[model samples]
Target: MKRPGIVLAHGKWDKPPYAIGTLADALRAAGHPVLTPELPWSLARLYDASFHDALLILDAAAQALRRQGCDRVVLGGHSMGANAAIACARRHASADGLLVLGPGHFPDWLHQQGISTDSLARAAHAVASGEQERLTLTDVFQGRPRPVRIPPAHYLEYFAADGPAVMPDNCRHLESLPLLWAVGRADAHFDLGRGYAYALAPPHPASAYHELEADHIGTPQAATALVLAWLARTFPEPA
Candidate 1:
């Protein structure tokens, strides 16, 4: 019996195919096929693509998994990658399951923190003025101020308060697929609790929320056992 294919996305400002390497390796060793895509928000690319473009990248990866003989596809991600996975599931509606670890990239929260407010305004102005040059924007990367250069139009798509990356809104639009949302106990976003976004997802018998003993970056590795158990239960091997 074939096991489900998994696409794991890396977090914002993190390197590709290695940021979530621990979890990806575990899943592969457990007999699941996994692909860790270098997302648009990765450290190397640094917002080279819009949030919508990131979804397109994920869509292509899912298709590749289907071509490789996977009977089912699951989308998993860490930090901003987790946020993107939720958006991808909402926009594509093709994934069979969702695994989110320490979901990050909340534009509204950023606005409240006063981190991207000025940059968002600048990006909006640049887009409105039809500027093509990339602008340096401030972002909270790993809990500190980091400067990222991105074209204004593309930046708006990611940092806009009501942009497509809003997890709660995205989770609300999810179909009947099962979800596994895991956050670290020491992670800052953990305080948001399930009510922040997990609770908004349509109820599914297999959906679950967990709190691990790790911080934001350490969540993927810490939740390995929990994730494996959940996968085995939710997607048993065919007889």
Candidate 2:
């Protein structure tokens, strides 16, 4: 009769407040245990952040949830965090469900906009050469037109869609688990032809995808109702 716990991961350049705070609060108020662990890629030194590092954080959070009496825990994240959540769920045997919000596409939509990966490559080189611990980069995916700063090594981990943390590759791991894939219709990072299709075409019988009217950051509120309904259906409480 116990509800499944949830471990929500925040997106790149984001923390619990502007990221999973609202959703976590709502889920907790609804009686579901929730934990929004701070990802290394969030506020930590950029050079030390990597997809694998974020996965470790998720692992720790999941374990903490288990210690807190949650036998099952749903893995969820927003934006870049979604990709991390998927990667975590792929290898996590105890991940009961997956919730992907505004998931980023492989090769990214910016590639279609003619944005080259030269910057990323150069940053990687710099990191390899020990030239810099952090680098300022432009991301067409997240909000604000201003440039953002990140660690070159971490950038490669998440942005190199062809890399190990590729979203499509991760989604393919969703076979029988319950999945809720939600995205904002106005999200600049979402590529319908690629990302959306990949998520919708999952072979899992319990998988469902929704396109909401909100933007990248608005997904938490926009998909709240649907998320709750799905949770209820997927993990019903015994009478």
Candidate 3:
């Protein structure tokens, strides 16, 4: 029998290639079918369409796996995608496991860097008043300046959604499902200590954390190996 299918959600502003494609290819080579959803977050106008929309995409992928004869599925993603995956598992009771790659504290990080929330507040008002469907902002992504135009409501929702509190909450929702969290050693985006603290704090039976040598964008090969090993230990293939 084949292993369960895996659904990967892409991070903000990312389509297929950045990091998910590499992981998907490796997982496929290891005999696990994978689906990388092109979420609303990938688009400019819909970039901040709320995690609920992203969950819909993930739900569709899981349903597709079931149609293809996969009994159960694992949910995972990179960056914002990882945030969506954990949130999906917390909201729905379908995922058998979770793989979180480089999920970091977006709001806190922005605040620390003085990213200027005054602008976000004004945009929020514009959205509430139906003045605009979206708003534009500039920030440094992957260490380079980039402009992001997104729905204001979505932007605020995501800001309130991600942080230290999310970990414990997600673990509570997950209950006993195996959860694997990985981050690179040089990842300036997320805090490794906090990741480990939360993963262990949940009292999850098999929750584990890994530190790779790569940076914010982790090593796909390392992630693939870790995921395969975890799958073998958590859900071995039947004879």
Candidate 4:
């Protein structure tokens, strides 16, 4: 097979348009063909029953990559997409690695599935207050990560499930892919403890976490650069 490429996935509230394209350009510059897809109605269904749709999107990406002769892929994502990428990588015949940048909503995702985060639960009143503009969110997102003003249907679709549902768990098999979990230490929406990455612990032993001195907004750029560097070292491009 040809040298593997990188597949980048984005999270809720963000469109897969220029955001992904721009990252693709950077990865291309790094010498790896990148596959970034427009997740199926993800922007609208993030809050709805879109988890199934999200899972399908991941499958479609893999199929698309395989058809393009990219069977060996390095799955990567920003925020929520990281979760999807992990699910996708684990479902297929395994991958080179899982690179997650600025993982978000992990606490809420887990909570929906009844995995309450005491840290977040401590802020229960605030969390349920429905505060449109939360200082905490601003602190984490920096540039103001608002509740994507999409249609109610779309919003409902977005959060279709209370998650951290362990997409890989469904198949009863974990992908032995290496993992590169990068997070901005300044990210307010991200608390490593709350991320509950413990589930990702042990097993393969080919994983590492790096803390960038940036918040959620700054993570994408920095994480992109880091991913490029790692992909070059791990899945080096054609000579």
**CA shift of 139, model 3, Å:** 5.1
Off by over 4 Å in 1: none
Off by over 4 Å in 4: 16-21, 40-49, 92-94, 107-173, 237-239
Task: Kindly provide the TM-score of model 3 when superposed on the true structure, using C-alpha atoms.
Answer: 0.85
Q: What is the lDDT of residue 221 in candidate 1?
A: 93
Compared with the true structure, all predictions reach lDDT values of: 0.89, 0.73, 0.70, 0.57
The all-Cα superposition gives candidate 1 an RMSD in Å to the true structure of: 1.2
Indicate whether candidate 2 or candidate 3 has the larger lDDT: 2
lDDT of 4 by residue, 175-210 (tens): 455778787888764464423662544455556678
Q: Which 10-residue window of candidate 2 scores lowest in summed lDDT? A: 193-202
Q: Candidate 2 on 108-217: residue-level lDDT in tens?
A: 54444445376667777987798756678755445343355767776677666466576666666655688888888888765563444354335666678888899888
- Top TM-score: which candidate number? 1
TM-score per prediction, in order, is: 0.97, 0.84, 0.85, 0.68
Colliding residue pairs in candidate 1: none
Q: Relative to the unseen true structure, what is the C-alpha lDDT of residue 200 in candidate 3, on a scale of 0 to 100? A: 44
Candidate 1: Cα lDDT at 117 = 92
Find the candidate with the highest lDDT and give its number: 1
- The TM-score measured for candidate 4 stands at 0.68
